[model samples]
Target chain A: MGKVKIKKKSTFIDMTAMSDVTVLLLTFFMLTSTFLQKEPTIVYTPSSVSEEKVPVSNLVTILISSADKGKVPEGKDATEAEGKIFISFSGGMDSTQVAPVIRGKMLDEALKVYNAQAKDSKKIALTDAQKKVFQETNMLGTSFEYLPELLSKSLTEIDKEQGDMYNPNTGIPIDGNKDKNGHLNDFQIWCRAIYTVSKELHDNMATDMGLTVDEAKTLGDLYNAITKDGTGIAIKADKDTPFTTVETVFDNLQTMSLNKFSLMTALTSEEEAAPAKH
Target chain B: MAEVQEHDSGKKKKGAQKKMTIRVDFTPMVDMNMLLITFFMLCTTMIKSQTLQLTLPTNEKVQKEQQNQAKKSEALTLILDTEYTDNNLPKTDEATGKTVHNVYWFAGLPDTTFQTNLLAKESFMGDTKENGVKVQQGIRKILREQNKDVMTNYDELKAQWKNREISKETFDSLAKKNAADSTLTRPVVIIKPGPNTTYEALINALDEMQINQIARYSIQLPTHTDTLLLENYQQRTGETVIRPTVRKSVVY
Candidate 1:
């Protein structure tokens, strides 16, 4: 009889298959991913059955901060933190009107309008470095008087300052500054600045492309994006927030003649009232 | 599959040749790829948010002559409100896990004297199935009944689209035209969200407009007449419908 020869197997794992799968997954994510824009606060938008998709570019988002219910300091009321407005602009897909460039131009135009309408003490004068910071900011939420100092801070400092909901200077002042009241509020000033800049950009693009207004309308131009298609300005508010909080934003938009806009919502499906099968 | 092997014939020559096997280890590569995937997954927003388009009449006041008034028979007003908890948060329904939103509706004009009891109350009950047949419930049912003329045409168009008889684009354009068809009898909806109403309640009301295919709808703040009707309803039903505003306006 022969002694049983024990065989030793190599202790190795062939990771080729694992690597292949992971590479495929990585590719999928890289191709399909859109980086989330950084905002000062997060809000859960109400869901709706409307199927219209938000446009990918040339959009202005108005974010309304909800009340801080969970963590309130000792003396302050929770509702005092509600209705703070923030504004962020996203430019077109093309290189000419990318976010940074559009933001820089908007700053210049807004400053001009604000300084013109604002009282001497309320005027905002930003240096070139501060303007650069403003261009890089994803969402801006400070009153006109506070803007010069807010933009001068470092990125982390700015974020920390704006994240404090109870800060008196944290939000853009959006009181009832009606158009018929003779002077525009800071919110209206921003709206007016956006309107002027977008109109100018649209006209310039139309002339440069040698396209007529009708042709530009078909080409997804800025004018159509803002006014005709009603997809440019989007109001994003929390689901649980009261209607009066959101209505103030709507009233301001209406005052600025931005009668047509969109509301951001998550998608949900409900059965149709019809008896037919979907 | 990762190993490379070379074979040499056992022949004596000027110099003996040695066989060699080459292998590549992919363990580190897999680890790095996993790390990258985690980063992308955390940083990416895969689902785009949906949008509902809305158009409000200009804030500028319009003269009475320029305003196209709806016929009294075709007018339907909805006053929306949301119940609030003692903590000032919106009170949620325990059964459905949805916030409690109440809809107070009246047809034609508000009867201030409460002689007709025209102001009826309804909640947003989306849909249900009874005895194997689909049925609409609550406020949706009422609105759909009022807009049956448009809904009938809409159902036909929807069926045609589902059967592949018409393209989606064609179906959409036709459906839009049918909704705006002036000849069909349609209800003119005025959605007045109360001060205590949540934004979600207002959105639900707007979504109803889209789902029911009602073309003429406008959002307006509640007037004094609406308040009077609510008070009457409260007195008759013994329901505490009116409350102080939960949100305090922030003034700089």
Candidate 2:
């Protein structure tokens, strides 16, 4: 505790290294970032304890959102006549109600894709140009009747002017109406289209793996060895959408014998709530 | 004359060098970088979404189940119904402040005995936190108690997995094995959402089923007996009740 020397040394420490590091990190994040895809609707998936990840490929994602009629009813035993989904209704069950709307753009790239060996364009009912657009665009919610128009329009133009063509309360119109031979609604037609296109891909893989196409349960099986657990159907619905809507969707699947599907939900990181327990 | 010129230039250069300094204050740059990092951190959705795989029975299968399995004790039916006062009519619940939801829960068929003891009317009151608490307190607690044995076994397996004594695959297999064991009691749950039941309550009920580890469960349509039970329940309670109606989907 002797002499208190008040010599002020230079306080400047070189932050050049730190700056370099931050810039590097920023660059890395910028390069690696995968931007969120613009969805037609904001689907707030319900939280759950189940942590099974959705399969990556050979999947058809179904997005379901509610259309609010006005103010939600409040009270015990409140009636749910307030909200209505905007979709064209066909007579099937109590199917007039609980219709959903989504818009899908057929990607142009898929129309160009044909069986190199067989060149079987006749198998499907669409012009090559139409098929190309159908394959290229994202499958949006629209009535079955509007599919032809959807096929004709350029997806990029639709993307730019999205709101003008927004058909409310319409989805791949499925009233669970099966034909004499068990053909479901527009939803099944969409699935058939996918299956027809993917047949070649599945066939090639099946052949490669020394399995017949017949043996491979492609449509309904969740854990198809050839597909490696591709659910094919991925349903993304808002937390508060009526179960009637979802059940009808399930009905559509059941009609088509598509039994297995995946329900998408947001993952909750448990570590967020952890106290300082080692 | 040249030596004199050089000496004057050198003197000029030395004077210029003394007056000027090259320095960069990077505090602003650092601040900008920090701001950007914070923005990205806040906006970025880091975690990937999870999924729940479900296999649904065909409509025919459900119909058969209703016909054949109603007598079974484990055949529990959970009908999710919405509440709107008759005055409110088609919709709109101006009278009640909370979103009125109810679950008409019962196990086995609506025999006189089953109706007397099995059926209970419960409200879907949001979660424990919210006044609308539809979480793990009411029907969930009851189901949890019913499936406690399997849940306990599954929990034990999970603990073992956490302690690194067993792998996840092993744990899952063991859990499956335990769930399938006939020695342990099992409850077959049937979930039926009325035409008006909000999607949230259905999901909450499904979530409850998973949380309680009740393995055998299904989403089914309400039967005639179920509807009758609801009518009886409404009459007894004298509360405005929404009836559970089937969607009449044909999947056979």
Candidate 3:
């Protein structure tokens, strides 16, 4: 009988389990990760030792940079090179000088709503005299025609003055034109962007469970709910900010009834006994 | 050889060869992964969401003191115009003795006269010819007077506070204390810069004030609200009232 030769057999391993694990990790990250919504507008915040956490919801961020001293030396943009940042009030723009900006916007929006509702309900065209009488009698009939006109004219004058004061190309008017919504277009755009980013993340999370936009409210509500229930908002400001600006910002926040906010700072490895004086 | 072959055949035939199988226990790996995820979740600091809220001071009629009572709390009015110098000092022409600087004091009113008069009073202990010398003397004198007045008022107010009189004297003392405390707390320098005064000038004034321990001060803004009736009465009657009643007045 012919002697049979023994041949070595090589083992072939399957990678199906490893592939499944990799896919699971990818899905996990896709489901859990959060995306940043807005490009951070540079704001100067004063340093603080307080460990209060700033809430993440309904946050109207105000950028308070040091005020620009004067015209920059040749070959430099004033905003870029000059270390001047004013205490900007969110929604109001300039809280110190033009506080009426926010009130004006709110009034304008309310007016538009009233106008739309009145046109639908009354279905009657009235003379100027009749309109005046209606305005006096109606509960929601406070006239906004004069206020809107006045605001528009004043804004135009302000734009003209600002144009004359600074280089037109460099200094943009905070209020350029009212949008169809009767709100400042820039502010509206900012709000829209924030809403979109937050909504997108929230929707993505809900998508796996087959949730719709109407069903899944934006993330802002969650943040608001959490914050409104006594959770504080945390703010992290850069060290170069002036104490006055910080105080002004703090005061403004207090005035707005956001007293539960806290300043964010770098956590030291060990808690120091006392804060260091400048 | 025949017996050995038989034995080998019998052994081979005893059982059919079985296929080798491998099994992996994923329980330990899953446990480690879960532990890692829990650790990360525990270590991460959660950030809170917040918004700013503010209540602006209303355009109410805050009472202004009577002229005679105003004497107790001297108003160091500094008018800042657009042409304020880098040091926040009004620019003065030595040759012409004119202020080329423009200010918003009274809608671009030339403040040279006011500054010159104020500086002279603040710095001069004795008559001086040099402008700089006079300015220095005037400032020194004004500061000394302010300190003396503050100390005296504080003492008087302390007595009245103990007695609960709450007189105009007490108010004046309180204002002075507030101003002094503000100066100490924040670096504010009061400069009457012209209406066209540059931001740099304002900052310079603030810096100067900070250096001189006068950091907490405020630039006086013109009163836009309706004048207080009490203030008007104080001015007319020359009487000091501790508390004024709040009443609405007809605009007409």
Candidate 2 lDDT, tens digit per residue, B106-199? Answer: 7665665334644588753323445763334667667766777887798789889999999989988888888777677778888887776655
| TM per prediction | 0.93, 0.70, 0.27
Ranked by lDDT from best down, the candidates are 1, 2, 3
Query: Candidate 1: misplaced stretches above 4 Å?
Result: A1-7, A272-278, B4-25, B250-252
Every candidate's DockQ is 0.54, 0.31, 0.03
Compared with the true structure, all predictions reach lDDT values of 0.86, 0.56, 0.34
- What digit string (tens of lDDT, one per residue) describes model 1 on residues A1-278? 99999999978888899999999999999998989999888888888888898888889999999888668999999888888899999989988888888888888998898888778877778899999999988998898888988988999999999988899999888877767346887788888888889888888888899989777667564557768878999999988888888998898889898889999988887763211111
Top DockQ prediction, candidate number: 1
- lDDT, candidate 2, A1-278, per-residue tens: 88999999956655666677778877766665645545544556765556887654335677765443345445422222212222211111222211111112122212222222113543234566765664455546554445456667788754443322233334455575644135345565555444443454445546766876667554332125113443556777765556667777777666656667777776542221101111
Per-residue lDDT for A11 in model 2? 66
Fnat for each predicted structure, in order? 0.77, 0.48, 0.02
Question: lDDT of model 1 at residue B49?
Answer: 92
Of 2 and 3, which scores higher on lDDT? 2
User: Model 3, residue A233: what's the lDDT?
Assistant: 32
Evaluated on CA atoms against the true complex, candidate 2 attains a DockQ of 0.31
**Better by DockQ, candidate 3 or 2:** 2
